[model samples]
Target chain A: MTAISGWGRYPINDTEMIHPRTVDAARRATVQANPGIARGNGRAYGDAAVGVRQTIEMAHLNRMRAFDPRTGQLTVEAGLLLTDLIATFLPRGFFPYVVPGTSFITVGGAIAADVHGKNHHCQGGFGQYVENILLVLPTGETIGASREEHPDLFRATIGGMGLTGTILEATIRLRPIETGWIRQRTFVADDLDTTIGALECGDSATYSVAWIDCLARGARLGRSLIFLGEHAALHHLGERHVANRFPLRKPSMSMPVDAPSFVLNRWTAAAFNELYFRAGARKAASSTLVPTHPYFFPLDALGNWNRMYGRRGFVEHQSVLPIKNAQTTLAEMLDRIAKRGESAFLAVLKKLGAGSGSLSFPMPGYTLALDFPIERGLFSVLDELDELVVAAGGRLYLAKDARQSRATFEAGYSDLSFFSEVRRTVDPAGKLKSRLAERLLI
Target chain B: MAAAEKAVLILGGTSDIGRATALAFAQSQWTVRLAGRSLADLQREADDISVRTGRQVTAHPFDVLDTDSFTVFVNALPDLPDVVISVVGLLGEQPRAETDLDHAKEILRTNYEGPALILRVFAEQFLGRGYGSIVGVSSVAGDRGRGSNYFYGSAKAGFSAFLSGLRNRLAINSSIQVMTVKPGFVRTKMAEHRKLPPLITATPAEVGEAILGGLNRRRDVIYVRSIWFFVMLIIRLMPERIFKRLKL
Candidate 1:
């Protein structure tokens, strides 16, 4: 048994990890092992992909099955990483329709989490682009799920958190692109109201997100810098890149070791936030052409960056609030966080459109994601925040949740009954299980 | 005149390193042919690489143990490949190999004799063509045999020596290049059971790039991690009186 943890590095578990190379081997292992869960790259940030009995690592099962260039349809194994897909096709003028904060995630994890990207306000979640899935049921029976076939099961499995079955492969639609560049327009919002207004104003953009300063209080509370972007057309390319529009470069900076917990205290966080806001404001002079990497995934430039949060690790509380009164609710939540005096190092706010899938996290609202180091009394503070979210008829994103109570989850996801019914139909005995499922009593 | 497309044939194509190397070569605009025991698995890999790189890829069945079929396999190819790589290896349980003669023989044959024999066949073909590159994937464990896994280590040692002799023989004409790749603790299926040091263990893709780089430079022998060269040299030069006492 090897000790493993999610990307957060907290809540470690000793699991019998199985690595299978082929689809047949994966099915056989699932059939023979005890209750288990399928893990892809371990990018979930929480225990949603870990199981005590077994955690089948699916990295080796990655392979491209087919591709139709005319229609931009690609079939790939579940273990294929989004990074590899982009490396192969980005130069060919194709890209995944939806990508989350990091492209290091696997296709299977994206589907299981129903992940959304900066463009979520317009394009929806990753599950919306998935055309079909080949799933290995708990009983080891392989079945196909798509919109026309097993539609209910399909919806449930999309964001079911891997409870329905182990995903073997998926067929997804890729969007055509002219270049690997984003034409970015930055806006600096003075406070919470302006931030919300800026996001609402940028809804027509293909992609939009904001970096908020949680430590700012009083007049500057919820002050943020919003970035809105659209894919750059061929004509937008400068002279240097016109000949080779899809230049890709790997990240070179990496955190070599776990930093001391004191490195992320309030003084450092406040100072960092101040400098960051100023730099962003200064850079907001005019529209700029940025590479896809920095425009969409700036944090990825630093590898193993989570190590900077310290060995105790950090937890991210991400919840989506309905449009109605979301501003007031966000103000109240930010007020509580500011009063607590604990630093939230990375806080993001994005607009979300209505999403498909029974357990999908979006609901045509605004989602605020806050990262706080695990320290004394932080859980209670997060508990209070959960209550505020629940009261506002919003739900927490399961992909980022590690400590929310079962009651809180049930209160948020009202479509649990449909998910449970599909679970019964596929895995009656609950042969497929995970730490997240156990904690949430799914 | 249009230049003919360069081609590479990879034996043991199902292995991680082989698959990765094939991808690297294909991405560089070379035709790739994958040969292994399972045509189905090889065909799937070929198709995947073909689609990803938009290069020509084909699969054929070849077994290292079946030496008699080597000639037939080479003859059946549509065209002679410019480069051939052998990446077959087996890491049997040390305890089982120590006690069971069948397991011991299987380990030795799989790691040493089989790869050597297959490469010899390809070397002959390359000599007839007057130009070619041959790469053999060996291991650092062969540098100095350890008490814990001498059976596997010794086989790799023999394979390494065989590659050296082949390189020496091919240099007589100075046209064929024989390269031996000694990777240390790669993070592949063969080493998954052991908890390798993250600092030293290389991903298969790293090994693939190293192999391609070594071939491009015409390096006779290359270590995936440069640190392994010093580590192995120290172990090889260690006094037997002191080395035999400690566990590796």
Candidate 2:
């Protein structure tokens, strides 16, 4: 058995990690391992991809099956990382329709999580672009699923946390871009109300997100810099970027190991947030031409950035509130964190469109994400936050969730029964299992 | 697929190092041909690389131990590649290898005879062409045989010596280059069972980068991570009395 953990590096488990390079090998592994979960790149922040008994590491199975340049549709193995896809296709004028904050995740992980991006307000989640998926059932039977066929299974599989089956491959439609640049504009919001207003006003933008100061209180509560971006066409580029139409980013620095536990304290987080907010505020005056990589995935430049949270690791609390009372709920959420003085160094807010899939996290609402270093009393505070979120008809993102009560999950997702039904249909004996599945009683 | 001006062939193409090196070359716009015992695995790897780089990548079946088929394989290629890399190796269980003649022979032949024989054919072809590069992925274990893995170590030692001899002979032809890469403790399947120190362990991509850099600079011998060179040097310098007393 090997010790493994997701990106958070917390709650590590001892499991046999099997790396099968071919579909046949993977099917054979599933037959041998009675209950296991398929893990892709291990980018999920929690135990969603971890199987205590056996974890099928899909890294070796990555391959491209087919592609149609004319339609920008590509069929790729589930293990293919979004990072590789972007590097390969951005230069060729095509890009994934929905890319999460980090491109390090795998296609399978994205589909399983139904991940949303900065463009959620316009493009929805990644699952919307997937035309079809090939899934290997626990019985080792490979079946094709799409909206037109096996619609229930298809809906259950997306954002199902790998409970239904092992994703073999998927055919996804890619968006075409003229250049690898974003015409970015920033809006500075002074308080919680203004931040919500700015986000609502920027809904027309192709991509939009906000960096809020969770520590800010009173007059500065929820102070944020809203960044709105649109894919820059060739004509929009300046002379300097014209020659190099598509440029892939290389991480300039890396955190080789976890920082000392004392490195990330309340004071340090506040100070960093202060400096970050001020720096972003300075750029609020005029629009800028930024590389798409930095605009979309700024933190990816710092390789292994999760290590910055120190040895105890960190937990991301991402909750989406219904559009009706989202602003008030967000205000209360920020106030709670600010009052505790355990404000996160990285807090993001985005507007989500109507969601698809039975267990998809997004809705026609606002989602707030905050990363807090794991510490004593942290769980109690998060539980309190969850209460407030649930009261406002909100739910937490499963991709980023490390801990949440089963009741909280059910209360948030009303379609849980439908998802469970389809999951049982595909894996009757519950042959496919994960830590997340066990914790959520899915 | 656009026809690349240059082409490179990779032996043992399904191996971690071979796959990584193939990706590095493909990204640099070289048409890639991957040869291994399993055409299925090679075809999958080739397709992946081709998609990632939009370069033509073809898969061919070539058994390293089947010396008689080497000539036929070369003759069957549509075009001769400008560069060739051999990454064949076997890390059979050291304890079993020590006690079993068949196991020991398999390791020796895989690490030494098979790679040497196949590379020899490619070397002769390069010589005839008067311009080609040959890369042999050897191991740091070759520097000094340890009690824990002497069987694989000795085979690598012989392979490294063979590469040195080939480099010496190829020097007469200025255009032909021969490079030997010693990757110490790579995080590939070969070392997956061991607890490799993160500080010293190199990823397959690192080894790939080192090989590409060495090939570009025409370096005759290279350690994937420079620290490995000094580490191996210290090991090679140890007195036999002390080395025998200490277990590696």
**The best candidate in terms of TM-score:** 1
Per-candidate TM-score against the hidden true structure: 0.91, 0.88
Model 2 DockQ vs. reference: 0.51
User: Clashing residue pairs in candidate 1, if any?
Assistant: none
Q: How many backbone clashes does candidate 2 have?
A: 0
The parts of candidate 2 lying over 4 Å away from their true place are A1-16, A19-25, A64-66, A215-222, A250-252, A255-275, A307-311, A335-346, A375-378, B1-3, B119-150, B153-185, B195-248
Q: What are the per-model DockQ values?
A: 0.72, 0.51
TM-score of chain B of 2: 0.96
Model 1: interface root-mean-square deviation in Å: 0.8
Q: Write model 2 residue lDDT over A360-385, tens digit each, in one string.
A: 99999999999988999999999999
Task: Provide a comma-separated list of chain B TM-scores, one per candidate.
Answer: 0.96, 0.96
Chain A only: TM-score per candidate = 0.99, 0.98
lDDT of 1 by residue, A322-411 (tens): 999699999999999998988899899999998789999999899999998889999999999999999999999998888999989999
